[model samples]
Target: MKTQVAIIGAGPAGLFLGHLLKAEGIDCVVIERQTPDHVLSRIRAGVLEQVTVGLMERLGLDARLKAEGLVEGGFNLADGERLIRIDCQGLTGKTVVVYGQTEITRDLMEAAPSRGLEVIYGVGDVAVHDIESDAPYVTWTKDGSAGRIDARFIIGCDGFHGPSRKAIPASAAREFERVYPFGWLGILADVPPCHDELIYANHERGFALASMRSHTRSRYYIDVPLTEKVEDWSDDRLWDELAIRLGPDAAANMTRGPALEKSIAPLRSYVFEPMRHGSLLLCGDAAHIVPPTGAKGLNLAASDVHYACEALAGWFKRNDADAVAGYSERALARVWKSERFSWSLTKLMHRFPEDGPFERKMQVAELEYIASSVAAQAAIAENYVGLPV
Candidate 1:
């Protein structure tokens, strides 16, 4: 196979980049190691920043998203008693959509063929070679046969663990990371959300969040020790913890149901500097990771894809080499800002074992300041709604 760009991973980022490139009349092929069914089975975050929503709109793939997604003008921050609502629309004139990342991937997947986007799933042994040179190619195996793709650029949207990022030499990159002490034990069920807007609660016990995928599907999470096991918590036990932490108001309207899916995900703040290494440009988890506190993970990926599209189109369509050379610097600026926001939000909302009384008091005082100060609220609101892409 041969193309202008070869994208690894069929996740939202890779698929989004492929769709955008195809729309730009730049030929690209996406490669994935998982089956389409397996890809869709992985549950992920549901918040949609404008960058994410706009991409779907630009690709003409927002029909299902527009019909099914819930539009929220604001979200809430609770210190176990009162809801400190950050009026995102009023403060920043913007709103976020409650739409699942899996849904976005599906939309891109279903629209791929019609848009002339090629995505190869369920491949094995995928690798990129000669990325430092102008001519780079990707090789993989499927059905016990080897395959190869020669392209002008090989995009590493394959994620952090995928071969693409590893292909970059350690000497050329600098890694920064902070792994959180706790993990979010999440529950997804077919029940209505407890509140109209998403709530991130900081309670005496720990941290909890009440979020929704739709009017009938709710997604809730509570921070737990990293040593905790998912199998240990029954549905009733999880719901009971959520009630106490989210406060009485949310608990009053909360609906409990059987868990459709439940799991514990460790939180981490990770960023690999210089997202581009020659012809291999990293996007999404391939380049960085943010805690889910501010719902920046998938949106960050979308922003990377936006830049990747711009860079690739400029190179292929306009013959601009500077566009490709500048991709890393441009993408990293926004990535670091999001990294800071997610880290700060995680620190404010979660209880650390090492945090003493002073730390707790500081969190309380900061929350109070945010609730009382419009400037503080506006800052939070802008970051929450997402900064300009």
Candidate 2:
């Protein structure tokens, strides 16, 4: 098969790109190693920044999101007994929407068939070939049959372990990574959320986040050692830990129920420099990852896609190569800012194993300042709602 672009992932990044390119009369194909069901089954963070929600609206994909997603005007940051609420909408004139990543993926996937965009799922051995050359192509195996797509460009949205990033020479790819010392043990339950808005709490025990997918579905997390396993945490034990970390109010209102999903995710900040290499450019998790503390992961991906879609559109629509040539530079500018925000938020809300009394005091001081000062709150609100794409 021959196309203008070959996308090596069916995740939001790739799907969004496909739709964006198609709207401009560009041909593209998406390849995925996993089945559609598997992709939808994976649980991910839901918070959508204004930039992301705007993109969804522009694409005519906001109907379900607007109707079902919860718009949160503010969120809370708790330090032991003290609660600091940051008014996101009041400070930045923007609010975040709580709609799970799975729903976004499903919406995009469902819309693909009607638009005639091609997505080959359950494929294996997907690889990019001759990316350094203008005549780039992708190869894979599907149902024991070999498949190849000759394309003008190859985009890697396949994520951290995907082969697209590795296709770049080790000498050219500069990677920076920091794996945290702990993980978040999270649970999804069919119960009302403890609070109307998300609450990020720092306590003597660890960190806890009270979040939700809907009025009836709640998602919560608490920090745990890297060695901790899901099997080690009973439902009761997890709830108890959350109550202790969340303080008196949250614990008292918390609803107990059987968890539908439970898993531990290790925190990390990772970025790969030069997001573009020849005809191959990277987007989303393939190029960068942020700690979930700031809820920037999916929004970051949306921002990358916004840049990429514009670049690709410029190339195909106007025969302008300047934006496409400068894709990496432009994307990295926002990527670094998001990285800093996520890293800062992580440090602020999480208890480091190595933190001494002085470090603890510093965290408390900063949190107090943020709570007391309107300027500090505005800055936090701006970053939280998202920087302009």
Q: Which parts of model 2 are misplaced by more than 4 Å?
A: none
lDDT of each: 0.95, 0.93
lDDT of 1 by residue, 167-220 (tens): 889999999999999999999999999999999999999999999999999999
Evaluated against the true structure, the overall lDDT of model 2 is 0.93
> Which digits, one per residue and each the tens of the lDDT, describe model 2 over residues 140-242?
9999999999999999999989999999999888999999999999999999999999999999899999999999999999989999999999999999999
Q: Give the Å shift of residue 315 in candidate 1.
A: 0.7
In angstroms, how far off is 161's CA in candidate 2?
0.6
Clashing pairs in 1: none
**Leading candidate by lDDT:** 1
